[model samples]
Target: MAARRPVDDTTPHGTTPHGTGYGALLRTPHAWTFLLPALVARLPYAMLSLGIVLLVHDTTGSYGLAGAVAAAAAVSQALVGPQTGRLADRHGQAAVLVPTVVVHACAVAALIVLAHSGAPDWTLFLAAAPAGAAVPQVGAMVRARWVHRLAERPALLNTAFAFESVTDEFTFVIGPMLATGTATLVNPSAGLAAEAALTLLGGLAFAARRDTAPAPTGPAAPGVRRASALASPGVRLLAVAFLGLGTVFGTLQVSITAFAEDAGSGGLSGLVYGLFATGSMVAGVLYGLVPWRSSARRRMVVCYALLVLGCSTLWAMPNLAALTVAGLFCGLAIAPTLITGFTLVETLVAAGAKTEAFTWLTGSIGLGLALGSTAAGQLIDRSGAPLGFTVALAGSGLGLVALVTMRRLLLAPAPAHRTVARGGAVREEAAPAARRG
Candidate 1:
């Protein structure tokens, strides 16, 4: 008979390859209890985002201004992210989430009222700022909870993230469609208003769950408090990677719409995004189902190469179907890279700082997209979609360069003992023998 696998904290339950990891998260009762509410909370915000852009653009007849408003929200989210993450880390998710949800609800209502009242453009932007700021870091918080609830099995953790990523993709694709339908059938603002209500309900429902508490992964330490999760070399490199990739994605979103519109198929923008989402969704699931056999370093290198290739193809091709195919293939890298990066982050930080660390990761991606979108939009105004895609492809290539440069810091050999302080700073002290090995 085969030797029985060791049973310990890390593997409290036996590892059933076919039945384990991401598959278990969805199948388990406890996991779904938390997952359901998170999904609902995200759905409305997703809808609200698309609805606002379409509604504002329709009302103002200026896509540029509408784009500006959307970008402003991204800025607000980035600005408040660290603090919000810290709050969730120190106090708890409920402590941070409850109030954020309440404020977000009120802020959205205010934005709608202001927009309808012929509020000045600047005033409308101001109102939207609060809405953006008030939104909770639900996605990050949810992921953190998984770390606590499923601490023993890193594979399961990977699956949870995979599940979250796919859910987000689905929401973006379906939510926008819902908003578009509502806008056509009723009024554009109607969809946004519906989003506002749904956001409050969904965010609050998730917050109310007892299981959604923040997890403390490592020891707490003083230095961890001031250290931006971005300060960690691993995290910094990952952030740079995200920046490049997000720029490509952000520019592509804007440029694709322009491409379709110029071709007299304006509605194709939604279809294009849908294709991208489908690719990501399909890839996320596959990434989770496949076993992780290679070392982290090798895996990341391969994944990044795939991403670079996918992006490069987009730059070279102008055909809509071809672009979509390339995008789908390129999207395959996103979830795996993110999962690996976040796992590395988990190993690097103290327990107290996990929230901030992950928040910074998410924030970096947000910031990159905002900057990329702004720059790409400007470029499109001057040059056009082909040039925009070229710039995006180049940006992604640069990310690969950044990753290659940091190989030593990231691919360092594991230490024997890893200790985390209260503030979430980590120190690795290798045993003399382990170092010798």
Candidate 2:
């Protein structure tokens, strides 16, 4: 078992411990050990979709097929991810992750082989399906651990979540460049094989850290029914908002690639696209370090509004250079919006339902990715890259609209109390009672 550090009662609410900064969380026992592996485990989340697109398109010479296959994989993940997270909540991360990793790795390996062998289109989709269904929800699991470990220190918990968001942005920045470079420079099979290897190694390493894993929620008491996190109007609104964000991301990826190809710099698409994440990552790190006085919902609204404005700039960028600049500005809003959304999820759901809630949130993003990719691909194919930008702009506009209309639903009553169970003892903590207007 990991060593338990008692919370410093002297620290006031909404503040970190008196002498420690956000950096102190990393110095806490086993923090780096767990975080490094989890980071590795999540790389494939960024890699696989783009990797599949590159691999299938290079082999089949059809962007349509490539997009459809990628969309299928994303849809499968969205369908299966929540169930896997629920199992992890009822059982444990190691138990759920070990088998799922094996299946996912095998599926990815099969995909590489099938793509290389000039297999039929149907066979490619067959290989892609299991990979997505079995992809471990490592990000959600890691956040759950943070929540479990820092339940008593709300301020530190917020910092930890910010750190996780920054890592996510970092993964996208690196993962795409790595995938595209490997596939373009070496061979498509090699890129996917690398992804498979990383998934296995990282999943195993993360699962080995049993000392820090949260205890399973186990079975509910007999005759006692529990409501799902989705039952909350706030959670539903947040999911829809996330769906919009996902559409922006998905469309931006496909559209940017198409735009780069049209500009005669296809090879630079990954690097050019990475600039977007670079901006988000820098912003996320800075966002995490500061204390914010605004409500999470308000922050989300402002960020979404900014996102729509940023994406609108894309429609006018006549070349890759201008688009890259627009991408940097567009990325500025992503991490802040996502951080606020996840923080709201934490506040809206019961502790027992956290892992599942996070998964559902992720699943919603996957659904949006599927929808966005499919629509953007067709639009780009028929009407060119400009129309693809329109899709992203429209999606962002919808998200901003949802936030404004549903702001009242999100202001519904927060739970009055929260319970944390540790070492066979149950402790009740008072939930913050304030609601933002």
Candidate 3:
């Protein structure tokens, strides 16, 4: 398969071709058409695990069980994610997403039914695996589209990635509120059902935009096997760092809920977590507007350092108010770190391997989430909520260490050209960072 070159005709007339501004990007033809559905499709990513925790605990009366079920889903997703990405890369996004969304929605619906039916505990656990596995990698696909659309404009690409990061934070904010509120106000089953409906609708809508999708790859040239993104030393280190960051997120979600339960305000857990996401959302928007002089690697390190400092402060908070404040402070670093890490991944791999590479990153986060939720749940069960904060602090510390120790690998220069396979022709262009000032 040969790389696809950028199409000069894609950009609409009267748009600034070289500008990194958001307005210019949004004004581009079919930009919002692609973004809106992708945003909707990813709402489940924020809701599913948290909804599972709430629903299972309400039915089974055990946070440990709830966490385990959620962890099961995360682990399943982690295992299956790359394979799904591979399929999307080799085939097409619609070919993979349409069927995957149907299975995922059905699985979620089944889980909801089982949860409400007083079924065996094992049944819910068994059902959650497929639900997670079927989750569409919306973020990666969207990023891939941006790579295709903005191939010639690195600055605009950075802005687009920043926008995507903000969208993720926004989804986290909205998803948890929707999930928890539905569970608390109506019924747990309703929350899951809503997730199912959204998954089906959004996934299909996103997939229907076939024009924006990347072209399917043909067979690799003889003696030129595609390199696994995980095999790259830099990507491996970055994945470990991402894993630790995922642990921080998973632990915080479960721990905050435990804290709310202890305070007799369990219904407020979503709001509290949403506030944390709100901080990151705001930061992501601002971060996108600025043109950074520092490299993505340096920016990532600084973000992690700030995150460590923020998480460390949670240890001293005496009440929910303090915890909320600490959470907001900690969130400031989250989006920046994620955006920089993803940008680094874009720089680290060939264009043909992007979806798989990004999925590997997502899988690392899932692995970390599974570990964090399981560990934090046990700690909260045995000790208390405050101890879970200690676990989060430790995870953040580990993430910082990983980034620091692997600084050299991360700082390596990005490839100078990327070969993209499109429509039986190969297109080569300057690497992502090559055009950056």
lDDT of each: 0.67, 0.80, 0.83
The alpha-carbon lDDT assigned to residue 340 of candidate 1 equals 62
Cα lDDT tens digits for candidate 2, 1-437: 22323221212233543323467667667788789999899987888888887888789876667777888888899889988887888788899999999999999988988988888899998988899898899999999888888766666766777788899899989888888788879887766777888889999999999889889877666766656667778789988888888887778778887888889887788897789999888888887776676666677788889888898888788889989999998999888888878877777666777787888888878777777877887888788887888878888788789899877666535245677789999888766533210
Once superposed on the true structure, which residue ranges of model 3 sit more than 4 Å away at CA?
1-18, 221-224, 412-437
Worst 10 residues of 2 by lDDT: 3-12
On residues 132-216, what C-alpha lDDT tens digit does candidate 1 reach at each position? 7776787788777877776666557656666777786787667666676677678768777777777788888888886647543
lDDT of 2: 0.80
Which candidate, 1 or 2, would have the higher TM-score against the true structure? 2
How badly does each model clash, as a count of residue pairs?
10, 0, 6
Mark the regions of model 2 whose C-alpha exceeds 4 Å error after superposition: 1-20, 412-437
Task: Give the least accurate 10-residue stretch of model 3, judged by summed lDDT.
Answer: 6-15
TM-score of 3: 0.89
Q: Please rank every candidate by lDDT, starting with the best.
A: 3, 2, 1
